[model samples]
Structures are given as structure tokens and as C-alpha cells.
Target: MLTPMLASLLPLLLLCRISFCQYSSDQCSWKGSGLTHEGHTRDVEQVYLRCSQGSLEWLYPTGAIIVNLRPNTISPVAARLSVCIKPSTDSSGTNIYLDRNGKLRLLLREQDQAQGKVHCFSIQEGALFIEAIPHMDIRRRITAFQYELVSDRLRVEAESLSAPCQPCSNTDMLLAVCTSDFVARGSIKKVDQEEDHSSVTVELSRLYRQKIQVFVSGGVRVRSWTGHINMPLQCGVRSGEGEFLFTGTVRFGEAWMGCAPRYKDFLRLYHEAQLQGNNPCQVDTD
Candidate 1:
């Protein structure tokens, strides 16, 4: 004998289990479509399905054709385009279209046609999904865009644009030590500025590498290019009464600061080099 509440919950639990098993065994397949713009006609081919264990499937349209030239049959200024989806009994088959607002929509229909080509489109949704390559006017200038589909989700990523070029900082501690002419722990005594350059005087406390004559008590001037010239320093040494690790070259009577490592970071790198039986001063090209 079953209670009324238990009998009511039994049907719902069985329905959930059946749905889960169906999704686990289901495989994705693409439905083909014909795209026509002006007089140019191309067939969009179906691709393989990608599915994970107990996850939603993905149907990819890998053979979607891209036509560059517009036909003379249509107007040169504005060309009309149409996409006709092949009829199928599968409920997963969807008609992909671009609304007037340039948004992608997945509708359950036998066929769909549009006026213009869309930037993105999908052939199916839910358990099975397919996204066409984005074809925007501005995409011509992009170098590359990465596309990925996982568990019925589509992701598109574009490479960063380049303008106003800047130099990248050197992150390798051992490489910074090998390329530098002088490495020491010092305190900034004064900062002097000119029309196009600035100089900072530092009092040395400890010397790690001595390419030139450096005194512990004497002041050392470090020159840096400023103003219009863009020589951005990676580690800035302020004119306060604190000790800092300095790495740079000494030319004439001034030291050109290229890198300034923190005390703890410098010590960690120094010990790591020693434990590996490698010299920090020697450059490792490999």
C-alpha cells in the first residue's frame, strides 16, 4: 500500500531518471542549410558532434562557406541574403536567424530566411548546439579569434589590439642579474631633474656585483631618461630614507638604473642560484 504523497513523488523521480539517461546516451548531429546572397549560393555542411560524459552535446558547423564578392543581380549598395534550413523530424534541429537588432535566435521551424548575413548563428540548442563563425565587417582587421564549444556553450575570444607600443619588463631574476653591470643594496640620497633627464644619488650599503669602483660611504648618481622619451622603469627607487636593491650600468660618473629588486626577492634568487650550483653573474642563453 502506497501513500498519496509517496505515489505523487515516485512519478517525478522516475521522470528525472529517464531524462538523465536519455541525455547521457544522446549524440549530436548537425542539420545542413543553404545560404544565398544575391546570386552567390553556398551549401553549409555538417560537422562531427562533441559530447562529454553525462553532459550536453555540441554540433559544430565546421564547413560553413564564406563568400566575399556580392553578385550583380542584387543592388550594389544593399544585398539581400537568405538561409533555408533542411526539414527534419528531430526536435534538436533549429532554425538560426539574425533578428533586425543583429541578435542570434534559435527557433523551432522548418525554414528561415533573412535579408543580410549575420555575425553569429546557431543551428540547434539545449542537448545539441552549433555556432557558426562570426563574420563581422570589423573582423577583417583582427589577426585571429579563438573559438571553443563545451557542453553546449560557445565562447569566442579575440587577440588584443596593438597601439602606442611599449616595452615589456624582464621578469627572470637570474637574467636580470646576468645582464646588469652593477647590483647592490643602497639608499636614495637625492633626486635631480633636468629638461629631458633625471638623476638620483644613492648611498651604497652592500655590493653584490662590482663592474666599476663603488664606495660604501660615497654617493653614486643614477641617470634616467624622462620627458618625451618613454623609458619606463620597471622598479622605481624613491628618494626616501629606505634601503633598496639596485641593478644597473655605471657610465662615466653616473649609474643608469635598469632594475631594482626588493631585498627579500634578491636574497631568494641568490640562494636559489647557489643551491643549483650556478653563477648568477654568468648569462644563461638557454
Candidate 2:
């Protein structure tokens, strides 16, 4: 809610002096308590975080916080970076906004934070303004979310994880194999359709790389990997398929399909690129 009070509140929050900040040299993540300013409910604090990806947690939120997010790497690409935040499922107690200069734009209401949806904005937009929603009993209140700086130009609006309806080009596929969060050889074991997306279970024969522990390795004797990838429902992806090379990005702890082609096709393309000395990166297909 853009109450008239917010207009006045914005300036106060923005101009607030640096107080007891929960920052570190690396400053990737921040965890603090609004109880620190418990007596001053109208007080404000500015938090600076420099990282490509990180999280913030505010316990017992009382006053307000201005979260300034910036990428650690300083370059022209920083201007093009999109800051995406996924609210914690249990997050509550504060309203979030985009604060540009003294102007405020609502990003998320306190209640909406419970839905745990992802939100994106350009780095040039503004710092995040999170104001505590006044409540008598702030004992059980907390506001938290994970943020990521997405720089992929292919992702028109920062939803870069999910592939579109059309298959990726040979060149994109090659790049994805090299740059994706996870690269694996697998087949669709199950496909569970959802309202907005489809969850595909991949029975992986080999997991060459993973940015995180998305795939689990079975016991030593069993020797296997299994993981799930989300895809756009319109892709019409099904369970039946030959072996495929799966390469995709991970967003908010979930894998999303990217450039995936049949294993044979990828082998052929890789071999051709290798002979031409044009492969972006090498994969040990052997």
C-alpha cells in the first residue's frame, strides 16, 4: 500500500546514517535483527551487499531497511545485470519496495512474501526499501529472501532457466553445455505436469558437472544420479525419449531445462566442432 506516509518515510530511510550493520568483507549475505532498533520504530538503516548472489534475513523487523545490492565485479555488464530475489516461503512482517532517489515503488507486500515468488529488477532500478509492518506482537516476524544477479542477455526478462518452446540452436547448445549450471547425460524418467510448468525427472547416467547438489548420487554399487528439471508446459515434453544431453541453468534452487539435444546429435556436433577447433568448451563424452 502506497500510503501518504511512505512518501515522507522514503526520504528518512534513504538519508538514514549508517548504523550497526551486519556486513563482512565479502558481504555476500546479511543476517540482522530489527530488535537492534527496537525502541526507535521509525528509525531506518542502510545495508550494503556486494555479491552476485546472496540472501538477507531480518528478524523481528521494527523500523525500515534500505538494502543496496551491487555486483562485486565492476564492469559495463553491471549496468545490464538484473537483480532477482526469491522470498523465503515463511517470510513476513515487512513490505518491500524499490527506492529510487526519494521515490518508492512497491515490490512486495508483507502478505505476498509468504507465496515465495521470485521478483526481478534491473540494477539501475533502485535499492530495496523494506519497511516493517507495524504490529503489536513482532515476536514471530521475519523477512528474508535470496537474491541473484543475472547477466544472461538471452533471458529477455531474467527468467533464464526455462527454455522456450523452440529447441536451442547448435551454437547455443554448445554454449549451454559449457556455461550451464548442470550438464548431464540422462533420459526423462517421469514428467509431472503442473499449471505453469512441468517437472521432468531425469535418470542420469552421468553427471559431468553441477553448480549445486541438484542431482543425488546413489550408493556405490547402484552408481547413478537422479535429478529434476522444470520446463515450460508448452514445450510438450514427455517421458519417452532416447538418451539426451541435458544442460540448463539453476534458478532459486530449481533446475530448468535449457539446451537439450539427443546424445547422438550432441556427440556428432561436438566431434565436428572439435575437428574444426571451434568448440566453446570440451566435454569428456568418452
Candidate 3:
């Protein structure tokens, strides 16, 4: 009872629907020889592994599981190094390592799935050797933690070995500004000459708000500019020449210099303060 044109169109529509469903599933498979850790030769066989739905369900849209076939040879100095399954969509994936003690540590991008199967490769004397792990269930072995959107990319914390997980908090510029007494742009002049003291002079380029002062017991008072602030010294801002963004107690004269920010970060914080209808320089009473 159907027209010829209508019948032909129906078949095409069904095919299109099937293709759409496949794409939406986000299913992935591995397409290369397995990882090689001990030799320079590549395995000739191509292995295909399906992504586990149980693992992919837990990750952010950008999260993925990594199966480190050999964790010991990941170091730069190691003669035989292997890397497989690098995510193509995101070049900013964090490098995680399994230490000898079985503790998984993040190698880059502290703090924070394309469910895909990646082929592992071993490098020897400048030649790439494929390493293979047969019938590996990667999803069950790796654990992901703290998957959150960080800027344009999803920041994820994950471990390769099956073990207990520790949580990490997400701290951004706005959170830092809201928690501190004041935020400003400044530069470190020099480390003070006092013995056994961790003090530095900061030349304030711009103060977001006026400085504050506080008094303690015994009628003693401290200034915020005296470097009583507890900023991490290892932030590499100690060279004392380049400009930086600082946040700390203005009254106590202690300031911690964080890294420099883009112009948009300062603008974003400025607008955030406007939304709250409160002064950004207001001191914390608690």
C-alpha cells in the first residue's frame, strides 16, 4: 500500500538511525599490537579490546581509563620506555605513574573517559616496539577520582593500580580570592637580611584594597607587609624580579605570592565581586 519513493526513503532512514545510535554510544576499540616492554620487536598480531561500560559510566565526558602495561619503565632515564593509548582528543591528559610501592602518583597536573583501547609501544634505541597484553580488562584495574570541569578541559585524578583512593579539592582563582583578605598584583623586592627568618619585601604594583592591621597578645602588633603570610616558597616566585598576583593578610603584613594571572582572570574576579555587591578587599572577621 506504500508508494515506491516512500519505501526507498524508509530504508535510508533506518540506516541513518542505526549509524546515529552507534555514534551516541561512544563505544571504542583498540586497533594495534599490544605493548612491548622488554624488546625492540613489535608483535605482528592486532588486538581489539572493547571499552567497558561500567568504567565509562563513572568518568566525566572527557575521562578515560589508561592501562599501563609496564609501570616501571615510564621514567625518562629508562632505556626501555613504553607508551600506548594516548588520547587523541585531548593532548592535556595527566601522566600517572605506578610507583614501586604500588602507590599511583600523578606525574603532571596535580589536582584534579573517552573509553578507548590504546596500543602500548616500547622504545629502544630510537625504534618503536609494540607491546601487547592479551585479554586485559583495563576498566576493572584502574580507578578515577575527582573528575571535574577545569576550564575547557575536564580535570581528572586517576590511579592505574587497584587500591584505596584519596580525595583532592578543587581550588580556582575565584575561590582563592574569596577566602583571602585581599588580592593584588605585586613583585618581591628582596629577601630580608634577618637571620633564620623567611621574610621578603614585596613592592605592591596595585592594591585591590587598602591594607589592614591586626594586634595580638602582649600588646604586640604585626604588619602584613612583613612577610608573615604563609605562601609556598617552592612556587618559583622567589626570584624577586617578575610580577605576580598575591593574596594574604593585609593587616598582618603577610602575603603569599601566587603565580601571575591572565588579564581575564583579574577581570573575572572583579566582576564576581560586583555580583556579590561586596568589597573585594573586605577583611575576614572569622
Give the top-scoring candidate (TM-score). 2
Off by over 4 Å in 3: 1-171, 192-197, 214-236, 250-253, 256-286
Query: In candidate 3, what residue range of length 10 has the lowest lDDT sum?
Result: 146-155
Candidate 2 Cα lDDT to native: 0.82
Tens digits of per-residue lDDT, candidate 2, 1-286, equal 5665465565565456433543434488888887777545776777899988899998988778889999877899888888889899899988999988767789898889987767788889899989888777546878999999887453442453343576689898899888888999989999999767899999989989999999999869877899899888878888885999998778877887888899999999999999999999888988
| Native-to-model Cα distance after best TM-score fit, residue 175 in candidate 3, in Å | 2.5
Candidate 3 displacement at residue 178 in angstroms: 3.3
Task: State how far residue 14 of model 2 sits from its true place (Å).
Answer: 4.6
Candidate 1 residue lDDT tens string, 62-162: 21221111112334322222221222223122233322222224432222322211122222221211223333232211111111221111111001111
The global Cα lDDT (0 to 1) of model 1 is 0.35
Off by over 4 Å in 2: 17-26, 136-139, 152-157, 160-164, 275-277
Residue 3's C-alpha lDDT in candidate 2? 68
Candidate 1 least-lDDT 10 residues: 153-162
Question: How does model 1 score by TM-score?
Answer: 0.30
Backbone-clash count (model 1): 0
Model 2 vs truth, CA RMSD: 2.9
Could you give candidate 3's per-residue lDDT for residues 1-286 as a string of tens digits?
3324323334443353345311213223322111321221211221122231111111211112233122222354443433333232232222333222222333322121233212223323121112112222433222222111111111121112112222212234445455545565556666543322245566554455434542121223522232333333333225444665555433113333322454355556556665777444442311
For model 1, name the residue pairs that clash. none
